[model samples]
Target chain A: MTRRIFGVRTLGLLGLGLLLVGSYFGLFVAPAERYMGQVQRIMYVHVPCAWIAMVCYTAAFVFAVIGLWNGKPRWDARTTGAIEVGAVLNALLLVQGSIWARATWGVWWDWDVRLTTSLVMLLLFAGVLALRSFVDDSDRRATWTAVATIVAFVDVPLVYFCVRWWRSLHQTQSTPETVSPAMVLPLRLNAIAILLIAIWLIAQRAKLERERLRKEQVDEPARVTAGLEVTDA
Target chain B: MSQERKRRRLLAVVALLIAGGVMAYLAFGGIGENLVYYWSPTELREAGPRAFGASVRLGGLVEPGSIDRQADGLTMRFAVTDGEASVPVVAETVPPAMFREGIGVVVEGTMLRDGHFQTQRLMVKHDNQYRAPEDFKPEDMKELMKSLQFEETGT
Candidate 1:
């Protein structure tokens, strides 16, 4: 318990540090674009959110595969937890991307492959959650979810390569050499920070789910006996 | 013991497969459109004068009086300046209507043999508020100063 508490506190401090550095570098250190003015600052939030959401989905898919192969209850729980978080982050990404697009592209949405694939990912997560709720047996849920997770992960590559494969206007990947030193440094730091925070959130939520399941297990027999007694009465 | 180890090994292999898929995508995915680059006029100039026909973006202030309206009046020619250097841009399309002298503009095209911009695209590069005439209103114009909210005066 103490170790768990320590882990959460450590992640919090680390996240705070990264946030401060990211904001400083992105806002103050980086030179403003010659054309876009300060609106370019939107890149700081938009890029990281998209990157982290992709990573989260990837992580969840890995765990889903592990759960399927090894039939491990822990991995199953982690898979579900990660997917839940990834879904929320993916939703935020869609919203933020739309906002940035409206500001930059003059339209709130587009039919581009990247946006479509991201929406597909969001729907995939929703589907997985729906499957989990309807399935009564834990093993069945894990098995089906593992299959669904693997299939949906194929969309990540589709999304990443969408611009290249199609004639979309979205720009290419963010590379260290392509960006100003000031901009790249903060972006790299924020990427790491966001990844860590995402992992921490998944871990925390998994732990809570584990504790809840354990409590339910402990109460199950008592509840069954109480029901039997009432029926007899 | 053997069965459990076999299962663990299977999971490990699956993880490796997923990793390999992501790596392959990173290496070769989206080859096109990834080349889209946004540069300031200052940086474009700093690149030390590309070959006359090299495609590049010349971003800067549209120099006053440099605008030459054609007889047709729909087409216009203007120069973008970064205070240090300037590039003349010839735009055939009707300017964004509100597009005028002294505002920020980004002209996308290649540098010509004569050092002018053979612009294929001309963008007004508006701030948060400046909507096009389709949604333009007097009230929206009033909010432009507040919405832009920049400290640097374009003087």
Candidate 2:
């Protein structure tokens, strides 16, 4: 266990190093955008964060599916960890996006389809987290959250396609064809950095959850025995 | 697998499929209802009376030399045209810095009974094209700062 913790810490440090290097290139090396100027640099962090958030949500969805199919506590723990991390990243995406919008769009927010759908996705997953906390029974909590996660994931595709489906102020997805090679390097690097950090955090969180489950298992017999004594008396 | 377990798995699959189908239907239905919040001036004109009093968005290029800012600085009148048709718009807010003539814009509001569109919000539509201007004049930067300040104070 100590070795595993050390490994995770090492991975996190590596991610931090990559993030600093990526930011250096993005801020100092990349050419300034013609129209947006310095504000465009925010894309280096904002876009990567958004991408990782989506990836995390997709991971949560996969774990939820496995948990439901097998009724496994391990999968449930993984799903919970992913959802928590994904929600935090999604929130950061919104904040960074709003700052960008203020500089470029001249407004902090708008009820555009893309923005609205993204907000709905965040709220839906947040509701799942809240629901899990409200349920007292461990098995019931796991099952309920797994089902909710699946249902909530239906919004993910809608969020991705909202800009294309409806007239939106938000720009469409940027790809190699749309972005210059010089700009793409930092974007890719930061994406890798964030992805590595997310993986490490999720792994640590899942381990903690598993430990709690293990302790519960150890205490289950004692709890039952105490209940039996009270009933007998 | 036991017969009971097999039956349970089949039931779960069927249930998931039905739920997915229902969700897809509802999502598509919502999108269809608000598909095009704004219509081009030509579309709005074709809708005629149906467009009147109904809250909708009108999108088009702003007509050059048609903007009239009232003395109050809050009330403004302009014309939005899609080349095929034009609509007169009256808005009660200072326009954005990019809200100049020939630029594309989408205004949300409703067509009044008096043959004018009353705008609740005005959004300037910019394309993905990015290029630095040849010159970064200090005066232009000052003008931009002034406009941004005006927006902050006015709103």
Per-prediction tally of clashes:
1, 2
Every model's DockQ: 0.05, 0.17
TM-scores for candidates 1 onward, in order: 0.60, 0.80
Candidate 2, what DockQ?
A: 0.17
* lDDT string, candidate 2, A100-169, tens digits: 8777666778787778888898999999999988886666677778778888887877778665555666
Encode model 1's per-residue lDDT on A141-213: one tens digit a residue.
6567776777677777667765444433344465654455556777777777777778778877777656654
RMSD of each: 13.0, 8.2
The interface RMSD for candidate 2 is: 8.2
Residue A233, candidate 1: alpha-carbon lDDT: 6
TM-score of chain B of 2: 0.66
Candidate 1 versus the native: TM-score? 0.60
Candidate 1 chain B, poorest ten consecutive residues by summed lDDT = B146-155
Error at A99, model 2, angstroms: 2.0
Highest TM-score: which candidate? 2
CAPRI grade of model 2: incorrect
